[model samples]
Target chain A: MSLSSTNSFEKSPVEKSDKGTPDHGECLKVLSLVLDQEATDEEQAYFKQHIENCMPYYEIYNVDKAIKSMIKDRCLNQKTPSDLVESIKSKIYQQAD
Target chain B: MSDNKRQSYSQREKEKTFEQEFLPHIDSMYNFAYRLTFDEDDAKDLVQDTYLKAYRFIESFEKGTNAKAWLFRILKNSFINDFRKKSKQPAKVDYQEVETFYNSEDVDKSITTDLRIETVQDMIGDEISNALNSLDVDFRTVIILCDLEGFKYDEMAKILDIPIGTVRSRLHRARNLLKERLKEYAQKMGYKN
Candidate 1:
C-alpha cells in the first residue's frame, strides 16, 4: 500500500543570506547530529538557520527524519518469539546444572 | 560456614544477580539477533549462544551499570564471529569502494532526489522493516542501535568497539543508503515531490 499523501515538507525561508549556507559535507555533519538529537543548542541553531536558507540541507534533513521514524516504527516492533525466551532459560539452567 | 560453603553462596548470588539484570533484556536482545540473522532459528541460536557467553564471562561484567548495553556488546561480537564462521560468506564491506562512491560526483545528482515524505508515510511497517533489513550489516547495526534502541553515540561506540567519530560517519552513510534504497519504493507509490 502507498503512503498517505501528506505534504510534510517545510517551506524554506525566503530570506536568503550568503553567510550561513553550509557545503554538503558540513550539512551532512549537522544532519547526522540533528538526527541523533546530539546537536548542541548552538549546532541546532546553526542547522535550523542553514536549512531555512538552503533547500538541499532542508530536504536531506526531512528525508533523514522520515527514514528514522519509519525504522523506529516498523523494524523495532518485531516480537521476540515466546519460545526463544524459554529456550534460553532452559539452556542457561542446563549450564548451571 | 565452611570456606567451600561461603564460595558456593557467593557463586549462587552472582548467578541470581546475573539472571535478574540480564533476563529482562531478552526481548530486545532477541529482536536484535533476529534483525542481524534474519531467521528465527538462527536468531534463537544466536541469543542462546550470547546468553551462554554472558554467563561464562559474568565475572567481567560490572554490576548495575547498563546491563543492556553490556549484553548487546557481547551479542554483537558473538554475531560477528559466529555469523562469519557459519555463513562462510565474506561479510566485510570494501571501504575503498564505499569511499570512491561517496566521493564521486554522482552523489551530488543522487542527493537531489529527495525521498518523498508521502512515500514513507504510506509504507507499511513491513516495507520499512524490509528496507532496513536490506542494508549492509554494519549500516543496519548502527541504525538499529542508534535509532531503534535509542543508544547514544557514545554507547554505540562502546557497543560496536569503535570511536564515536566512526559511529557518526557510519550512521550518516547508513541513513543515506536507506534513503537511496527506499527512494525507488517511494517513486513506485506515485510520490510526485
Candidate 2:
C-alpha cells in the first residue's frame, strides 16, 4: 500500500531541537521512541519538526513505519484455529466442576 | 496479573470475565503463540494452555483493565517455562551474550541498509514474513510486541519482564536487524540498493 501523506506532522515546518541537534544514532532512537509513542510530548514534537529538514531521517521514518505496517498486515493474518475456542471453553467448564 | 493484589471473582463472574474480557483477545493470543512456535499444533496447544491457566487463576485478573497485556504476559511466561526447553529449533543462545554483542560500540555505528521505501512496499507478504521469522526469537519478540501488537514500551517491559530501557534498545536493534534482512532480499531481487 502507498504511504499516506495526510499526517499534519509532515506538513510542519523544519526546526532543530533547542536541546541541540541529535546525531544520527540518537535520531534513530528518538525515531523509534516517537513512533512507539513512548517519547515525551517534547521529544515527539522535536522529532516531527526535526525530520522535515533531514532527508535521511525522513526516509528512515517512512521506511520504518512502512515496515511496521507491513508486518502487522502480513504476519498476523493466521486465523486462530476455530476448534481452539470451543476446546478452551470446554476445559474452563471442566475446571469449574 | 500484578502480584500486589488479586481481585476475587465469584464463579459466575469468573465465567463472565472469561467470556467478555479474555476471549476477545484469543486471536491475538493465538497469533503470538504461532509466531513464537512456528508450528500450528504447538501454537494451538500453547493458547489452550494459556486460556486454561487464565481461567483457573481468573481471580487474579482485575476487571476493566488490560486483559490483553495480562494474557500476553502469561503466554510469554508459559513459552519460556514450558516451550523453550523442548523446542526443536536451533540450540538456545544465551540472552546475556546476545545483549552484550548488540550493546557493543559497533551497534551504535548506524548499520545503514540501502533498501528503499518503494522496495519495502513492493515486497510481498512472504518476503517480509520470512525476514521477520528469520531474526533471533528475542529480537523477533520485541518487534512483534511493539510493531505488530502495538504494545507501548512500558507494557512491553512488564510483559517481557525486562526494564523499559532494555525494551527500547532491544526493539531498536530488532528493527535494524529486520531492515538488514530485508536488504538482502532487495539485493537478491536485483535491486541496485
Candidate 3:
C-alpha cells in the first residue's frame, strides 16, 4: 500500500467551537505579515513566541515555505560548481577525516 | 583597514573581497533564479548574470542595506528583463480559479475547522516547486521570499521594491494558490480525502 494514495487522505472533521476564530484569523494575518517583515518587532517577537508554542502559527511558516520553494529549488539545484566548490568540499572533508 | 579606504573600495577591489561573501550566496541566488525562471539552464545564467551585475554595481549598494535583498532585486530584474520577454503564452490568471474547484473543506455544518496541515507539509519538493512555477510572477515572488528564503515581510518589501500592502495582498493570494496546488498534488500523489 502506497502512502501517497489520495484515498488514504482524510479531510479531518472540523472540531466544533462555541467561539469563532476571528482573533485566530487575525493572528494568522499578523504572523503572515511577520514572515514578510511587515509586523513590528514587538509583534514579531510576540508571534515568534506564539508560533513556537502554537500549531496554527507554525502552519503560517509552512505556507511561507511553499511560497519560497520557487527560489529554494532554483538556488539549491543549479549548475554544478566549477571544480571550485568541489575542491573546497573535498578539502574540508579531508581535514575533517 | 581604515574608514576612508573602506568607503572608497573600487569596484574591482570590492569584487575581490565580496566574492567570498558573494560566492557563499551563489547557490541560493541560483536556486532563486531557477524557481523564478522554471528552467535550470536559465537559472544558472541568471545567477551568473546577477553576480556579475552585483559585482559591477556593489558601490551603489547602501552600506547598511541588505545585500541579499539587493542581489535578489538584481536577480529578479534580470529574470523579468531577460526571460519574461522571450516567453509567449496565455498568462493572466486568477489563481482563485483553482481554489474554487477543489472545495474539499470538511466542516460538519457545526464544529471547529481543522485545516489539513501535514500532508501539504510532506509533499515532494519538486512537485511543490512546479506548483510555484505555475503561479504568476507577482504572487510567486512573495512566496519565494517569505517561504523558502525566510525573508521577513518588511525585508521582502525592500527587496521587491513594492509597498508592504502589495506584499501582503500578493502573499495572501499566493498562499491560496499554493494550497490549491498542493491539494492537487496530494490527489495525484494518492492521498485519499
Candidate 4:
C-alpha cells in the first residue's frame, strides 16, 4: 500500500450500501467535526441520515482521531524569536567581515 | 549643499521609508512569522530580515497595491530561497529524506470517535499550535493563512500567488491531516475509549 495514499472526500470508502463492512472513511470524515460539537444542524442531520443507511464504526473511529489531532496542544514560546534575529544579524556581520 | 549632505539626506530618506512603510507592519509580520517558524525567535528574526530586505528594495514597491500581501509574498519567497536551506553542519532536514514526512501514518487521530467538547475547548489553544506544527511547511503555511489567520480564498490565492483551486485543495487536505493529528493526540491521552 502506498504510504501517501488517502481516500478522497468525494469517494469515501465508508459509503457502502451494505452494513456488513463498516464505513470507516465516512466515519473518519464526520468524527473530525464531532470534536467541536459545532456542526450545523444540517451537518448533523446529514451525518445521522447517512449513518442510518450504512453504519460504519471504523470510519467513525478514524474521524474521531482526526478530531483529537485537531484539538492537540502544540503551542511553542510566543515571544521567542529575538535571539534568532540576533543570530541572523551575527551571520550577516560574519559574512561581511 | 555638498555631496555629503545629499548622501545623508538619501540615507535619512531610506530610514524614513523603512520606518513608515515597513516598520509599522512588524507586529502583523511577526504574527505570520510566529506561525511560520513555529518558534518565536526564528519568527522575529525572519520578520526583521524581511524588513531589511524590504528596505533594500523599497524602490521596487509600486505606488498602490496590497502592501501586506506584497510584504508577505517577499517574506515567503525569502524563506524558500534562503532560510529553508540545509545548514553546512548537517542538521536533521534533507528534502528527499523529509519527503516522506508528509506521508500518512497508520495511527489513531481518526475522525470517527467522540471526544468531549470540553476536552477540545480545554486543548484547542494549545492543540491549534500542535496541529499547525504537525503539518509539513507547505501545508502549514496554507492552513495558517486560511484557517488561523482567516484570509479568504481569493485573498489567499493572491497572497500565495497560486490558483484558487490549489489553495482550496491544499486547505482541504491540510485540515484532514490536522484532524488526524488531533485524534492521535486524544487517543494517546486516553481521552476516548
By TM-score, the best candidate is 2
Best by lDDT: 2
Q: Which regions in candidate 4 have their CA more than 4 angstroms from the true location?
A: A1-77, A80-97, B1-17, B39-41, B87-116
lDDT score for candidate 4 against the true structure: 0.54
Q: What CAPRI-style quality would you assign to candidate 2? A: acceptable
Best by DockQ: 2
Each candidate's DockQ: 0.26, 0.29, 0.12, 0.15
Per residue, candidate 4 scores C-alpha lDDT tens digits across B1-193 of 0111222226566556555665555556777787666566567767877866765565666534456766777788667766666322222223232222223332133233354444555565666676668687777777666544445667677777776545654654666666566667767777863
Full-model lDDT for every candidate: 0.73, 0.79, 0.59, 0.54
TM-score for each prediction? Answer: 0.82, 0.87, 0.64, 0.55
Give one digit per residue, the lDDT tens place, for model 1 in B1-193.
0111222226776678667988899888989999998888888888888888877777677655688898899899888888857887576554543233334353474457667666777888877888788998988999999988999999998898876756765776777778777877777767765
Please list the residue runs of candidate 1 whose C-alpha ends up more than 4 Å from where it truly belongs after superposition: A1-21, B1-9, B97-111
- Candidate 2: the clashing residue pairs are none
Report the C-alpha displacement of residue B176, candidate 4, in angstroms. Answer: 1.0
Question: Could you arrange the candidates by lDDT from highest to lowest?
Answer: 2, 1, 3, 4
lDDT of 1 at B144: 96
Candidate 4 docking class: incorrect
